[model samples]
Target: MLGIGVVASILGIAAGLLIDWFPVAASEEAKPIDTLWDVLIIASVPVFVGVSVVVLFSVVKFRMRPGEEELDGPPIHGNTKLEVVWTAIPAILLVGLCTYAFIVLTDVEKAQANTMEVRVVGEQFAWTFFYPGEDGKEISATELHLPIDRPVKFTLQAKDVLHDFWIPAFRMKKDAVPGINVTYRVTPNRLGEYPIVCAELCGLGHATMRATAVVQTEADFASWLEEAAKPPAPPAGGGGGDNGKGLFTSNGCGGCHTLADAGTNATVGPNLDEVLAGKDEAFIKTSIEDPSAEIANGYSDTMPKDYGQRLGADGVDALAKYLSEVTKEG
Candidate 1:
């Protein structure tokens, strides 16, 4: 039985090691974290096989038989050496694993020189990223963009409820708690687009809370940052087309509503294309500012009610006019 168990344990460990279980590693911090996971799997599989083997053997060998239904089996004392061996083995394994984990954590978290700071704000159903711009201003965007091979320190904040800022490829995550700030750091070593997900369930639209992280060449990143930092051009003829579209994209409206004009297909909220057809600008503006005034059929009042504050009067007017124009019936 011991030899059979050993063989099974070896096979299990090999299988665990061979399985590809993670997403692509895109950051410098991901390597050590992935290694830690592999180490855990290697250590855990043998213990799991040993336990299962013992349980199965006991069940087969010592289970009550038909003739022994009313019998109490022989009384047995606990084995002191066995008890100590099991306890001590687990204790030593835990201490070693924990010490290794601490070392990996410390290495990943060591602050690097010239780490760029990015502010991440999580609201119900949306994530907004802010990067420092020229002077004292900040450039805000719905998508996170990082320069490849640069260390980035993210300061996370939540406006309404708790949200977890997770980048799986980077293998780093932290919670954004309301009324406080949390931080984590990563250095992008790959040039690719990765997903940004809210690991916490914030609200009704929690599952829809998603964003993209783009790692770009340094020159491209610099160019994009400079362009994004510039003030938005005023809406043409008081908020009709391009500027309103920009607002829609930047504010993450596409994350909830299905807007054909904006090329968004998310249905967390109403289908703006169908619902807003023939609706006037006043109604649209009210819907944007006070979304809870009238709940749509088969939908909850989950829209954020701060568009009036987030986008000022002129901004709201522009967005209203834009939606009104795009969804207008002939």
Candidate 2:
């Protein structure tokens, strides 16, 4: 016990000192989480090193020799003191950790006055961000834009399967499950573009499920929000279209199609604007609702089998009409 304590203390002290020597950049809102992690490491390191040293010592000292294999070992006996010590210590430590983690989680997610509200909806392979536009109406899109230094409250929910929303630099992540809404807050300290990865494997195309989160100055974010609020620019022919066109990355259309106008870089599908340029509303609607009915030139039949069900009749109608209007004439 004395040896174990000395070794553990020495190793832990060395590591702690090394870590302290490095500079750590703290987040504006993640301070509470960082503090929680620090406490856990302090409490855990000694216990971890002590157990490891003890295990190694036992392995080396009690290792069976070649001649000892045929002989029976001494009668095994359990030590009450050792068992009680392990049990009680682990229980107490776990309880403490749970308490501190819960406090940090709740404190970080608590609503703050003047916090920005954005609705984050996730589907099988896409994410849509919604902001309150003029008249307090909702405007939806595929990209995420947040103002730096301001707390952004995200109301996260799933439209289809389960997906996790994570921004590593911000140190905040939460699951978006169907039928339940999860919330988290982030105050982006940096002004740059970061990738939003789906940490949860929702389906086959999970590997390609990604979006960009742009953190800009307050003025830039405000201007971007205003631009996103404007009605989605007409597609091609002047007519009604789906309102959800704000940002639809899930259709895997981005995987094969190239719609430069929509900022979609997907090369899996045909150039949408070029393909739909001269097509009438019926032609475009049929192609989207019944994609396999007429494959868009070089694209496959994987353009979301249930887009009709996912977006519904009105959504399909608007999208088809919008496509017809937006597709540039060949």
Candidate 3:
């Protein structure tokens, strides 16, 4: 019995050590919270082995012996001493593990120094990130970029419905609420590109709504920020107004809904300037009313299908006409 126990115990410890590799493959974070997971696994293994070994021993030793099938074994009542031992041991083990988990959570939640602030607004099937540049000037973009090895604090908000901003490699996520802002922080130690996926289901195109998170060096980030701040050149032709703004909105236009003069910086919809360039009146009108008939690549068909109902004939006509004239070539 002594030899069996010794060999089994050594094998059990080796098995536990050998299998410590995480199946999740997200070992990169190495945040203090992840250490709690290791603690839980380590503390539970010995208990698990004890249970299994006892069950196997009982099966082998107490199987129906000769003439034992028709006879009752000696009746033995539960021992209070044994009960106290098992109960107290498990309680102490649980208390210790729970205390460690709480401490880790608290540590990971502590705010860090020099964290970059970004307001993440989640819309149906898309994520729009806004960073306030110098002097309270803001930059809006679709794709996310972060400076490597810096702490980033994200303020999450939802425009229409609930969405979860999750980056698997970072092992962090937060819920975007429509009326309120939820905040979380993460420090990315590694420099690489990773996919930012929405874990929550929002609407029809939920499955297809995805974006990239480019972790760049500090120098690259400074360049990107500068370029975003510079104003675009005015259109060669006159830009539309006097409800040309509404014309822009109803068309579901703007690089990202911005009122850029002619440039499409963040346009998820049709770039009025680009799409209508060299086009005549008739083609532009047809394209607006029947958009799916001409889908734009790199964007989903999330444009309201009931535009014809909401806009009426006159609205669509004016929008297309405005687009055609202003976007005309030299």
Candidate 4:
């Protein structure tokens, strides 16, 4: 029985180690997290095999024969030593695993020198990343960008409901509470793009709340940051299709509205292509400024109502004009 259990444990551990279970580890913290997961598998498989082996052995060895159906089995007594051993072993294992987990958590979350701070804001259905820019202003973008090998401390905030910011490759996640800020840190060690998701269900658009994290070379990140900090050039002839599209993306409009022209297929809110097809520029402008004024059919009034203040009159006019033209043309 012991021999069978040992072989089963070995096979189980080997299989567990061999299987690819997680996405690519893209952050320095991911290595230790992955190692902890392996340790858990290693420690767990043997116990599992032991329990399964004992149960099977007892069933096979102590089975009642057909002739003994009317006879009672001999009385069984509890072994105090065995009980103590089982309890102590599991307690020890639990303590050891918890200590190791705590150590790993501390190591990953240790504050490092020269850590960059990035502000992350979560709304009903979108994520906005804010990086420190020149003159103390923040450069906001819908996508997240970080430099490889640099530690980034994200300050997470939610404008409306609760949200969770998660990067699978980084192996770190934190909730964006509505009234307070939550923070987490990660050091990007790989230069690649990874998906950023809202792990918390915020509202009707919770599933569509997604973004991308781009881990880039230091030089490339710096160049991108500098360019993003610069004010966008006014659209030629005031507000045109290109400018409107930029506004739509930057403001996270496409996160809840489907727009064929913008290539966004989100359905959290009304489909802009259909809704704005026959609507005039004035109607589109009103929709942008005050989304609650007229709720679209089959959708909640969850669209942010501060766009009038977020985007000035000229900006709103540009977006409305762009939407009006694009929907009509399509």
For candidate 1, write residues 185-218 as lDDT tens digits: 9999999999999999887667878889999999
TM accuracy, model 4:
0.81
lDDT of each: 0.86, 0.72, 0.66, 0.86
Best TM-score goes to which candidate? 1
Question: For model 4, what is the C-alpha lDDT against the true structure?
Answer: 0.86
Residues 38-152 of candidate 2 have per-residue lDDT tens digits of 7777788888778877788889998999989788878979999999998999999999899889988877777767789888877766677778777766776678899888888
lDDT of 3: 0.66
| Order of the predicted models by TM-score, top scorer first | 1, 4, 2, 3
Q: Candidate 1, residue 281: CA error in Å?
A: 1.8
Summed over model 4, clashes come to 0
CA shift of 149, model 3, Å: 2.4
* Per-candidate clashes, comma-separated: 0, 16, 5, 0
Displacement of residue 191 (Cα, Å) in model 4 is: 1.4
- Please list the Cα RMSD from the true structure of every candidate, rounded to 1 decimal place: 3.5, 5.3, 9.2, 4.8
lDDT ranking, best first: 4, 1, 2, 3
lDDT of 3 by residue, 1-330 (tens): 446555676676667666745423332245565566656656776677677778888899988978777987889999999999999999999898888877766665678889899888776556767788777756655668888877888999886678899877777778898899899888777777788877898765465456678788899988987775564321211112225443453232552332345333455555556666788988877765776776777767766555455456766676667676777762
TM-score, cand. 3: 0.59
lDDT of 4 by residue, 1-330 (tens): 999999999999999999999899999999999999999999999999999999999999998888988999779999999999989999999999999999999999999998999999887667878887777766776779999999999999987679999999999999999889899999999999999999998776678788999999999999998877776543322211236877776566877889998889988789999878889999999888888889998988888887777667878887898899899955
